[model samples]
Target: MPRLLLVDDEPSQLKALQRTLRGLCPDLHMDLALGGEEALTHLRARAHDAILADLRMPGMDGLTLLGQAARWQPLAVPMLLTGVADFATAQRALNETGIFRYLTKPWEPELLRAHVCAALAEFQHRVTQQTQAAAWQAEQGVLSPQELERLRLEREEPGLTHVEWADDGAVLMPALDAHLPSMPR
Candidate 1:
């Protein structure tokens, strides 16, 4: 299940956010924090797919919290929900924190829900892309002789070290040649 963390100094605001989300997404798992410290504690305990924080908290503003959240959960989508509509703060949040969305106070429930859904989708996409890239890298890279031998042994039987190498640091697998028809010597 996708998880979300919502941080706000006001308990009522947190409740409203949770209510809006629950109405939109019944299956979403949400964790609420009253402050940045509480939010960090929740982050350390479990992984969340998205984080939405208030911009002006008593201590540890949303930008700072989101920046730290990024360090802890690099893949988590960070979002800012602030009453202040300062352009400089928005720009800083985008550039420094890499927030997926910046929403102002008195947010529309439907739009907020849509943004959360989009954030969750973005998180899933990032994870899928990372997995695919890693898999492609593994397939394209040359495996060392020891790794090849291990794979061969695991596939067939133990004590089967069929990996061969030339003196010039090139891999020469004898098994591959054995599969080919005999050529004129």
Candidate 2:
């Protein structure tokens, strides 16, 4: 099941945001936090696919929360929502916190839903790719330096290695065919 963490100081705002996205994600396990500290506690306990936080909070701001969240759960997609639109803060959120999206207050419901869905999809893809790589590595233990580099590159930009699989559970190497002479047509 996909998990989500929502953080806001205002209870009403948290409820409203939760209500808006309740019907959007299927079997969504959504968690809410009253403040950044509570959100961090949740992060330490479990992993979330996405995190949406209010920019203005009592102790820890959204940017700070997300920055710490990234350290705890690097794969979770972070988003910031704030009524105040400050360019400097937005820039810091993007550069330092690595937020996926920055939303202003009174946002359109449709847009918010779309952004959340996109973030979830991206998170799922990352998890799937990581699993695939781990499986591949386990099958072929003690990979060489070059092969390790390829794996790293593939993780950074998926499909970079052009990996193919055969029906018999073997890796296909189509490029090798060009170097050998054909026996029969």
Number of the top-ranking candidate, with TM-score as the measure: 1
On a 0 to 100 scale, what is the lDDT of residue 150 in model 2?
68
Question: How many clashing pairs per prediction, in order?
Answer: 0, 0
Off by over 4 Å in 2: 136-185
The lDDT for every candidate, in the order shown, is 0.82, 0.83
Q: For candidate 1, what is the TM-score?
A: 0.75
Q: What's the C-alpha lDDT at position 66 in model 2?
A: 92
Per-residue accuracy of model 2 over 35-154 as CA lDDT, tens digit each? 888887677666789999999999999999998887656668999999999999899889998899999988888999999999999898877887687668757885666777765664
Query: How well is each residue in 1-185 modelled by candidate 1, as lDDT tens digits?
Result: 78899999999999999988995565789999988988877876677889999999998989999998886677789999999888999999999998999999899988998999999999889778755655565577755555654543432331133345799989875455432334688
Model 1 score (lDDT): 0.82
**What TM-score, over all chains together, does every model reach?**
0.75, 0.73
